[model samples]
Target chain A: EDKVVQSPLSLVVHEGDTVTLNCSYEVTNFRSLLWYKQEKKAPTFLFMLTSSGIEKKSGRLSSILDKKELSSILNITATQTGDSAIYLCAHQETSGSRLTFGEGTQLTVNP
Target chain B: AAGVIQSPRHLIKEKRETATLKCYPIPRHDTVYWYQQGPGQDPQFLISFYEKMQSDKGSIPDRFSAQQFSDYHSELNMSSLELGDSALYFCASSRSGNIQYFGAGTRLSVL
Candidate 1:
């Protein structure tokens, strides 16, 4: 069965701290991995990585994929109270567009 | 920029009832996807349609059915609602080989 696992299911840190979230997947035909930050409503697109070793960054958030290890990491620097939300990792297989999501890392940034 | 739109931000229904959730994709998007997120759970892919055709299916229950129309809009029709059916239903749209844009989900509560 294909599955995606995320570590440190929950994390807490004061403002300005940095955090790293990990996601590993086991699937038949790997295509791409995506990162999304979900607030109270919908999950917003962050990054999509199809190639390994190339880091994708936007603002204070960046992510990289390690295809050899079947895993990926999301790094958030200079965290703020506004960054408190669930960070989700999902993957799509080459066969279709269906996404398999990890449990997500709940991040709480205290001021 | 136009984004994916979903209807009935909130819905309450009794067990054994039925519900229909609508989704309007971003203008010109070619694919539509449906997901269900339980309390504190990652969003799970339910189904997807591309060009008005069923492209893929995930862990959707047999009681649930979905379709995309000629205009590229989609609808998820859920029947025989159970307490376990309560979840946040999200509709996402994307162009092939592009990142999906998620709509503000419909929160369904089955009492």
Candidate 2:
């Protein structure tokens, strides 16, 4: 069965700290891995990683995929209170766009 | 244009009643998917319509059904609402090769 698992389901950190959230997926014909951050009603897209050894970055947030290991990691630097949200990782198969998502990691950045 | 739109931002219904949730996919997209998210849980796939056809369904119960119109607008029908069915329902639309855009979900409470 295809599955995605995220570790450290909940985390609390002080502002300016760097945190790493992990996601490992076992999918068939994996096409890409994507990340999302959800704070309110809708979840916003973050990054899509389709290759290993390459990192996708947006400001203080970046993610890398390890296709060899069938895993990915999202790193947030200089975390702020506004970044306190659920970070989700999903795997997309090549055949279809239906995404399989992991149980998100709830991050609390305290000031 | 609006990305994705959903109706009844919140709904409260009594047990044994029926509820209808609506979704208008992104104007240019051809696929619509429904997901349910309980408090502090990952969004679970329910059903999807793509290319004006019923694509697939997840592990949702039989009481839940979905339909898609020729215009790609979709509706999710839940019969005999149960307290366990209370959660936030989200509508998402995506083009064949694009990332999904989600609507502000409707929070349903079964009393």
Who wins the TM-score comparison? 1
True contacts kept of 2: 0.41
- Taking every candidate in turn, the Cα RMSD to the unseen true structure, in Å, is 1.2, 1.5
- TM-score of candidate 1 on Cα atoms, chains taken together: 0.97
lDDT of candidates 1 onward, in order:
0.93, 0.89
List the candidates' TM-scores in order: 0.97, 0.94
Q: Which lDDT value does model 2 have at B76? A: 92
Model 1 lDDT at residue B72: 98
Question: Which pairs clash (backbone N, Cα, C closer than 3 Å) in model 2?
Answer: none
Docking class of 2: medium
Residue by residue across A78-103, what tens digits does model 1's lDDT show?
A: 99999999999998886348888999
DockQ of each: 0.72, 0.58
Q: How does model 2 score by TM-score? A: 0.94
**Candidate 1, CAPRI quality class derived from DockQ:** medium
Candidate 1 stretches greater than 4 Å from native? none
True contacts kept of each: 0.74, 0.41
